[model samples]
Structures are given as structure tokens and as C-alpha cells.
Target: MDRNSLIMSLPFRTSSPPLNWSSADCCNWEGIACDPRVAYNNLTNITGAIKILMRCKFLSVVLIGENFFHETIPSDDSIAHSNGFRNVQHLSIIGCHLTGQIPMWLSNLKKLKILRLNHNRITGSIPGWFSTLPRLKHLALTHNHFSGEFPKELCALPALISAQALENDTNTSILPLFSIFGRTIYQYNSVSSLWPGISLRNNSLGGKIPIEIGRLKLIRELDLSNNNFSGNIPSQMSELTNMERLDLSANRLSGEIPISLANLNFLAKFSVANNNLSGPIPSGTQLQTFSPLAYDGNAGLCGSPLPKECTHTVKSNKDKKTQDEKVGGHRIPWFQITVVLGFITGFWGVCSSLVLNCNWRNAYFQFLENLGDQLYVTMAVSWARLLRRLL
Candidate 1:
């Protein structure tokens, strides 16, 4: 088919009425635009793009995502016939159902800035060559079947500001295994405006999160939840001064939740639930304000935000008392028990004696009556004397 016929074959059509292909300038084609120097195509498929680029030679931006192109990416030799694809700055193929590995040919697009291949069936490791894109800023490879260790080199891209690789099969021993990123961390020191972040939630990653991660001072949001990580939270994370949100929940991590974490003043969201962690929850202003659910499932953790109180010493004291009582022959509390028993025995003994002796009871009453008369007489005499003195 000719280029015009091939364009019409795809699902998209011109918003304007049909036009004569022979008489009209192809630049005026709907869904296609060109200035004196550049061409822009919003195509449904890559086929039309190849045809257009071969003729126009000056295309810069390609927006072909959400087009339902379920085929594998074309080989480099097939797509790179001319230099037409080299100047592409922004390439978005999101949710396009594109399958197979990321084409190696992409390395040729040296001017690429934004590469978004999210929500597709693309498999295999993320090629390390992506780090070579000097101008790449946003790299999104989330929600795919890509498996392998996370490419640490991506951390060093001088221009990268954001990278999202969540919901994939990428397996790493731990987050701090930055054999590739160790150098990258130093490279990022001079660049100030970059507020880079990484999201690697819902994977099978295991191991201790390395302390070296603190070097990523520019990172703002980090998520490493729903994995098999085990160990203490690195106190070095306290150095992430710009951290805004951190989620490390649903892992096997154990140890005291680092008190140093309180230093992250900008931390807004924090969680370490469902881990083997123990100790007092950090009492930082931000940590104290988080929901109890953030620290739930960790039975050993305690403090204000959680209902579990930190009473290890109190518990130990009670245990010691029990053990002492057991070893000391279950000694009775004589002071308390004797006082109670003596009062009861003495009260009942006297009452019983008084009830049984009729003669003594009668004498006791008679004696009480006489004592009353004598006391009354004495009081009467005293009152009379006081009155005489007053007169």
C-alpha cells in the first residue's frame, strides 16, 4: 500500500472531512502537523510514523500510546532506515499492549527526555543502557513483568528526577545493593533541583536495606513495601532530610524502629507494619501523628501512637516477684493476714462470750447504769460550781 493508503488502514481518521490526497499538501493531513522546521504526528500505529518520517525527515515528538498495538517492537534495522527518529524528545507508549523486551534500538534516540512504557506486557530486564540517555528525566516502567535486579546505574543519571518501577517481578537481595548506584550517588551531589524518588513496592525482594541508601539526599518519596526484607531499619535513613513519605510495611524486618528516624522533619507518611520489629515507636512529631495502623502487626513496638505500652521492665519485675514467691515456699503475708484474722476472731469471741452468759450480761448492764449515774452526778456538780463562780 502507498503511504496515504497505509495511514487510512489504521483505526484513526481525520477529524475534518475527507480531503483529496493528491491535491492537498500531506503536511495538512489531520492528526499530523508540521512547521517550517519540524513535524508532529499523533498516530494510532507506528506504521504511519515510519512512512511519514521517511518523507518529512524532521519529526520531533511521537505520541502513539493507548493505541492497542499488541505487536512486538520493530527491530532497529527496520525502524532506523533514516535519521528521522533520532531527534525524538518525548516518547510515550503507555498502555499500548506492546509486548517483549525494550528494543535495544532505543539507545539510538540520544535526544530522548521522557520515556514512558508503563502498563504494558514488556518483559525481561530493564537494559542498563537506559542510563546513558543524558537528557532522560522521567523513566516510568511500572506495572509490567520485567524481572532481574534493579538497574542501579539508573540512579546516577544526571538529569533523572523520577523513576517508577513498582508492581513488577524485579528481585533484589536488598535495597542497598547499589554496587552500581554507589558511584551514582556521588554524581548526584552537585545537582540541586532534582527531587528524585523510587517506588519498588509489591515484589519478592529480600535482604537488609543497606545503610548507603542515605546518600540519596535528593530523594523525597521511597516505597519498598510488601516484600521479604528482614533486619533493622537503617539509622542512616535519618539523613534523608527531604523525605516526605516512606513505606516499608509487610516485610520481615526485625529490630528496634530506629529512634534516629525522628530526625526526618519533612517525613509525612511512615509505616513499618507486619514486620518482626520491636521497641518504642519513635516519638518524633511526624511519627507520633501517623495512624496506629502504620505500626500495627508488629507486636513488640509500643508508644503513644500504638496501644501497646512499652512495659518491659514492669513485666520483668512481675516475673521476678512470681519466681521469688515460688522459690521462698509461698510465704503468707503475715502482717496483712494476721491483722484481718485477729480483728475477726476477737470480735466474734467477745460476742459469743457475751451472748452465752445471762448473769454476766445482766451485771454488765447494771454496772453500765451505775457508771452513768456517777458520771451524771459529777457533771451536775461541775456545772453548779461553774455557775456559782460566774455569779
Candidate 2:
């Protein structure tokens, strides 16, 4: 099929008319911009993109993922020096055994709408320049080795902060970006590729989650799970009135869950498990509608949905520790009891032999009597001998 026919078969702008094969020249079709340089939507089976791919002046989409090249992402001076994939809208390189940092030249993708590099071995900090991409959306870096605090500016992206909800008609990516065992996180059709959100799950990114994140008012998915993020969740996150899924599990976050989270009426998926979060779960909200396992691994959390009830007389950590110590103090030492039992057994065994056998008792007494007589005779003889010598 011709390039135009292929592009038409996949999702593009909803306004694009149905392909009329009756027409000879595709250029005559409505909304068909015949720009000679615009050869886009490359879905090739190449192992790795060579330098020439970066030089394509009008290539619009690059989706090459799920391969076993074991090679670092290829780069060259063209990407660093000139407009690099300037018109590219979607870029995905997932599960390619890719290593090394994301090339800094990606900042050249001023028009990039979606970026997915999950399931690779990429390391190094997330580039701060990512926030500068005005049209960027739907970033996924899950299952990588990215570390360091997220750039606060990332949470302030104009598209994420105030982008209107996707209408039913907008075109989205032609391929699946996030999948587990062939199950995709989102469906193949009607879901916008430019969904306003981010996922950094299963990385080493640390530091307090940026309070600026609450500004993403229209974001649908926000996942920072299985990282080292700490500190209290921002109460301002409740402002995300349109959020559908929010996961902060397996982090070091402490303090009470923001009671304001109860206001997340649109939240379908939520988890805060395996954190240092404490206190009663906020009452009378959708938070209680979730499974108790959603709140598991937090020792200090209590109340509805959990087996631990919040008590009027709350105990402090010090008090609980002292009570535990007192209980431990009363435990009997088994080693000392064993020693006492051994001593009693030995004493009883000897005493029982003498009492049970008359011969043993008589022999014992006779030996004592003989020893006493011998000692007395020796003393008398010694005294008589001394007296004779004196006379």
C-alpha cells in the first residue's frame, strides 16, 4: 500500500474522511497535504535506527519497540546540531534492551506529543529539558534505572495542567505502548496518544513528590509507584478532579494520607500501600470503597477497610515500645530452668539409691565407721609414743 493509504488506515485526526479507493490520486483527497518531505509513521522492523533516520526532515512518528538489539540508542551530530525529529509526534523504544541515558538531543523534538522508553535499561537522571517541550504528553519511563528528583517543571506542563479532556474523535497512537504479557493498559482505539500524565514506576527516583504535581488538573494517570519517594502526599493533589488512576505504592512516603483525597470522586484505581503513612483513613469517602489491600504494609494506618480500628486512646510509639519491653521482661529463661531440673535429678538419683537398697545404706555407714576408728587409733598411738619418749 502507498504511504498515504497506510497512514489513513491507522488513527489520525477524526476529521479525516474515510479513504475513497475510487480516487486515483490520493493528493486529491480532502485533508491530504502532499508535502514531499513528510514521509512519516515509520513502523519498520529494523534492529536499531541509524543516523540517517534522525536526518529525516519530516518524519512524524517513530515506533520501534520490543526488540533484542542490546545496543544503546544510536545518536549522531545531526541530532545534536540540527532540528532532530522536529515533527515527530510519538516515539517509543520499549523493551529493546536499550542502555545509556536518553540522548539530550530529544529536546529538539519541540512538537513531540508522546514519549515512551519503558522496559529498557536506561540510566541517569531525567532531563530537565523535558518540561520545555510545549506539546509533550504521556511520558512513560517505567522499569528503568532513572534516579534523582523529578524536575518540578515537569508537573507544570501546560498540556497536563490545563488541557481539555480528549473529545471522542481525536486520533491516537497506532500501536500499544504499555502492555504486560500481551495485555495492554489501554485499548487500541479512541484513546488519545497525547493523554496528559506520566509514569515513573519501578525506578530509583527519590525525594519528595513535587507539590507542583497537583497543578495537573486534567491528568488521567499519575504513577510513581515502587520508587524511593518520601514525605507527605500533597493535599493539593485532590485538585486533580479528573484523575482516573493514582498510584504511590512502595515508596517511603510518611504521614497521614491527605484527607482531601476523599474528594477524588473520579478515581478508579488507588493505592498507597507499603509506605510509612499513618493515622485513620479519612471517613465518609470513596477511599473506603477500595480493597483493604490497597492500604496494606502501613503499620500505623487504622479504621474502616482495615482490621485495625482507630481508638480514642491512641498509643504513641514510645508507649507501645515500653509495653512490649515490659512483656518481654516477664518471659521465663528456659536455660535456667533446665539447670535447676538437672541438679534436682542428680540429687534425687543418689538419695533414691541409698533409700531403695539396704546394702548401699549399710556399706555407706560401715565405711564411715572404719575411717573414724582408724583415725582415733592413730592419734592414741602417737600420744603413747610421745609419753614413753618423755619418760
Winner by TM-score: 2
Residue 89's C-alpha lDDT in candidate 1?
A: 56
Q: How many collisions between residues are there in candidate 2? A: 0
- Among all candidates shown, the one with the greatest lDDT: 2
Backbone clash pairs for candidate 2 read: none
lDDT tens string, model 2, 1-391? Answer: 3444444443343544556623544445455543322222343322223333444555556656765346776555555676556667677777776788888778887767778888888898988788788767689999999999977888866667655423232434344343342354643431254456799999999999888888888788899999999999999899999888899999999999888998789988999999999999998999998999999999999988999999878799988866665654684566798999999999999889989999998998899999999999999999999999999
Off by over 4 Å in 2: 1-50, 55-58, 164-185, 188-194, 314-391
Candidate 2: 10-residue stretch with minimal lDDT: 39-48
Poorest lDDT segment (10 consecutive residues) of candidate 1: 171-180
Q: Rate the local accuracy (lDDT) of all candidates.
A: 0.64, 0.74
Q: Which pairs of residues clash in candidate 1, taking residues 3 or more apart in a chain or in different chains?
A: none
